[model samples]
Target: MDAILNLRENAARQGEKTLTRPTREEAEAAVRTLLLWAGENPDREGLLDTPKRVAKSYGELFSGYNESPEEVLGTTFEEVSGYNDPVLVKDIPFFSHCEHHMVPIIGKAHIAYLPDDRVVGLSKIGRLVDVFGRRLQTQESITAQIADAMDTILHPRGVAVMIEAEHLCMSMRGVKKQGSTTITTTFRGTYRDDANAQARFMTMIRLG
Candidate 1:
């Protein structure tokens, strides 16, 4: 299990490349180019400020890249009086952009971790979701990253993550299936080994 997790982490690191980020002015100029590509005049009265607005919006939308999951999940509470059960946070609403189309992927994530000794704040779980959700991602990568972060940081007995989202790339473009939703899940350690554990996690999500 550790080896698998290490491989995943290594692969993720290998996939990352350092690139100099563009200045806000440069970003706005790029937005203007995109507007032109979309067959719109950037200098039009109504569109004059659109590039600046888009640049500002992108800063907020992709802020996840500036955050560190280790910082978010590093702190844990060990004061619980032998309380070691599945701690689940469900229906955490998130908005992400698909890596392929840069369109919206609106979804909710359900996360559960069977703690070995310590647990993180419930709100931290929600924040953890945002830490990944605010970046370009696929639902599958988000699901796996959440579960992996929980297992790796908290040293949990198990971790379960389920994300259900509607990808605009598919709904608005390809198939044009407006309401179609995609679901992805990741289970680690005990949840992966025990069917009952997985079932209990699902039950908790459903009951929530």
Candidate 2:
């Protein structure tokens, strides 16, 4: 049991270390290289400052890569007016980049959690989504990360997250499915074990 606990602690430490931001210069150089790889001259008049601009833009877009979702969810409110119901925050807008193609994945996320003894501010849910979404990631990882963050911080009875996104890599380049959207979901604890609870959460999001 001690060994298991130690291992878990080590893993958590490693996860914390992974949350770091890149230096501005590094981001700029990467953007420059990307432009060159795309057969564009980074030195061209119109493209001269493009690398810096892209780097700055990436600092905002991928800022989540440096942020800890657990940290973002640290503060909780105990006063809930005796409301012991599932807290649902839906249709939170998000933008992410596909790690594979580096193209945009634009979407909305629906999140719900059943509190155990504590509940987070409603805006925190949206902020949590942004913290994970503003990075180069897969939809699967993004969905799972949000669910895991809520589960860990809130220690809730259950957590559920669903993301619906359209990938520009597919729609703008390969196969070009313009109107197609991909849906990904992750559920923890009761959200996974109870069908009715999951169905109700999904229904609420769909209706809205």
- Top candidate, metric lDDT: 1
Q: Encode model 1's per-residue lDDT on 1-208: one tens digit a residue.
A: 3323544565678895434456789989999999999999999999999988998898789877767789899899999999988888899999999999999999899999888988899999999999899988988899999988888888999999999999999999988999988989889999999999999988988992
Residues 57-174 of candidate 2 have per-residue lDDT tens digits of 8768877756666777889988877877888899999999999998999999999999887888888899998888887789999999899889877899999999999999999998
Q: In candidate 1, how many Å is residue 3 off?
A: 29
For model 1 the local lDDT of residue 187 reads 95
State the weakest 10-residue window (summed lDDT) of model 1.
1-10
